[model samples]
Target: MSPVIETNGLVKRYGRFTAVDHVNLSVEKGEVFGLLGPNGSGKTTTILLLLGLTEPTEGEVRVNGLDPLRQPLAVKSRVGYLPDQVGFYDAMTARENLAYTARLAGLRGTDAAGRIITALSRVRLADVADKRVGTFSRGMRQRLGLAEVILKNADIAILDEPTGGLDPQATQELLELIGSLAHEGMTIVLSSHLLSMVQAVCHRVALFNRGRIGLTGRVSDLTSAVLGGAYEVEVEASGADVPAVLGGAEHVTGIAVAGPGLWRVDADADVRPQIARRIVEAGGALKNMSIRRTTLDEVYVRYFQETKNQQEKKDAEAA
Candidate 1:
């Protein structure tokens, strides 16, 4: 099947500064795709281009096989967007706010009323459907925004910073809701800078850096590609020579001192047995040892660190 969204050599520039530079992306249908990056990294710019809110200086974009630039209305009809700061009439009830949205989308009467109730129930706000939106918390507002999307019966949902400023409980609830959406066959495009949050909900992610995509793939794939391993072992041992001894163990790709007696070891496989034996041979008292799959946070940090190092090398050579 063709991608639900595709962009080729997408670029946007203001003056001499490019906001999005030569980005090529493809998002499949029914999957949650994440645009991961810090602020000013061009994630929002790319979204605007996709939505036809802004025209790209150069490149091609197709949203569900239609050109967003030339067919914006058609694209808007099928796409729902929830901005970082979701807006609503504070005095209006939850159902009232969604009813207003439904009218704007040309929905009314029984059709609109049924959708309002169903959307509210899907987002778990059915009981509070009549409560004023002004009394709703930040998390509640976010879910309400999502309800608006569901009410539209949109094929694609683009959420910008959906969980930003949400507390732990709220974030978890929102993430679960997002997962359920994808499970029910809605294509979701999530944009956020929180590495761990993106890892929790996104099936695949594109890491943005300085108007460019540094890497794009499944989190586990990126972890192995960037860190040179998929397994990370945390070793807590006491001895002056422990680091040196562990560094030489087979299958160990890299090791970093995490704390006074804690070292994070990156390896290709589960080398806990080898690591344990090495610590004993070196006479290091092992306090603790644990292993788990490498996380996106580590992959993100290591990928950018490598990019910085390469740029520095080229600058030194130029000098």
Candidate 2:
């Protein structure tokens, strides 16, 4: 099947500066895709291009099999967007806000009312339906924004920083709702700086840096590819010589003293047995040890830094 969303050689520029470089992307139907980056990294620009909010400087975009640039209205009708800064009329009630959107989306009377009620309930905002948006909290407003999307019955949902600024409880609830929506067959494009939330809901992610896509793939696949054959071990040994003891352990690549009696070791594989033996033989009492896979944050940081270093090297060479 063709992609639900596809962009080829996508580029966007402002005056002399390019905000979005050539980015080729394909998001399959029913998949929860994530766009991860810091501020000014062009994630939002890509979304705008896809929604026809802004025209691309070059290349082509297709959403649900139609060109967004050529068929803006059709594309907009099928795509629902919730930006990082979601806005609602302060004087309007939650239901009123969504009702207005429903009418704009072409639903009216009993049909619109039914969808409005269902949408509010889906986001767990039914109790506050009649309450004014001015009285609602940030999380409540965010959920109400989601209800507006549901009322539109959009085939594709685009969310930018959906959980930004929410408390722990609210974040968890919102993330769960996002997951449920994908399960119900909506193609989702989630743009977020929150790594843990992306790790939880996104089946795949593209890392944006300096207007370019530096990494893109399944989260686990990206981790394995970037952190090949690496493992982090935390050992608590009761001796100042802990690092010295594990320095010569099998497959041990690097070791650092995290704190008193705490050491972090990196190796090609499970070197715990060798590490344990080395520490014991060196007369250091081992308190505890644990090993785990490298995290997404670690891989993300390393990728951008490595790319930056490589670019600097090229600039030096050109000079």
Candidate 3:
């Protein structure tokens, strides 16, 4: 099946500066696709290009089989966007904001009213519907922004750091909304710095850095392969040279000194009992051992650190 959103070697430039450089993406229908990147890594630029907010400088782009560049209005009509910093009239009430956006989204008369009420209710903003946006907290405003987007009943939603300033409760609510939308087969593309949140919500994810895609794959497969379900075992000993001993162990992949008299060894698989016996036989006292799954944050840091090192090496070579 053709992808819901596809970009081949997409590039975007502003004057002499390139914002998105030869980035590629593919998102399936109903899938929650994520762009994971730090600030200024071109996540927003890529979104803009995909949503027809900005023209790409190079390569082909398509959104749901339509050329967004040629039919921007068509794309925008079916797409909803919630920017990182949403702009709204501070004096307007939540109801008022949603009502206005709903009308502008092409809903009319009774349809607009129904959409406004449904959206506000979905975000639990009905009680605060009459409250002025200026007085609303950051989390409240984030909820309002979410309401505004769905009011249009868009097919594709593009959210840039959608959970910014939201508390745990609000973030969870937003995540649930995304999952609900996906269950209805709504295509979603979002950029997030929240690794755990994305890992929980997104079916497909891409790691972006320096205007390029560093990695893209199914979140489960990506993480499982990276982790290999390894366990960490720490031992205490005096000058036992744990690394040397573990280096000879067939199942041990890595060993490092974590602290004075503490050694951390990475096992290929969970073999805590075997490792304990080996340590005792080698005269190394087993202080503590714990199994830890490699979290999304750990994977992100590892990959992004590699990206930064490579970029630094390029800069050094240029110099």
Q: Which candidate leads the pack in TM-score?
A: 1
lDDT of 2 by residue, 177-212 (tens): 989999999999989887767898999999998788
User: Given candidate 3, what's the lDDT at residue 267?
Assistant: 62
Ranking of models by lDDT: 1, 2, 3
Q: Candidates' TM-scores?
A: 0.92, 0.88, 0.89
Error of 1 at 287 (Å): 4.5
| Residue 152 in model 2: lDDT | 90
How many backbone clashes does every candidate have? 0, 0, 0
Q: Which candidate tops lDDT?
A: 1
- Compared with the true structure, the alpha-carbon lDDT of candidate 2 equals 0.88
By summed lDDT, the worst window of 10 consecutive residues in model 1 runs over: 239-248
**Per-residue CA lDDT of candidate 1, range 1-319, in tens?**
7799999999999999999999999999998999998899999999999999999999999999999989988999899999887988999999999999999888989999999999999999999999999999999999999999999999999999999999999999999999998899999999998998889889899999999999999988898889989999999988746668976778888898898899999998999999898988888788899999977887888899999999999999999
Flag regions of model 1 displaced more than 4 Å.
236-250, 257-263, 281-287
What C-alpha lDDT values do all the predictions have? 0.93, 0.88, 0.81
Q: Which segments of model 3 are wrong by more than 4 Å?
A: 224-239, 248-252, 310-319
Q: Write the per-residue lDDT of candidate 3 for residues 68-161, one digit (tens) a residue.
A: 9999889888888988878778988888877788767777888888778888888888887888898988777777777877787888999999
| Superior candidate under TM-score, 1 versus 2 | 1
Q: Considering only N, C-alpha and C atoms within 3 Å, which residue pairs clash in candidate 1?
A: none
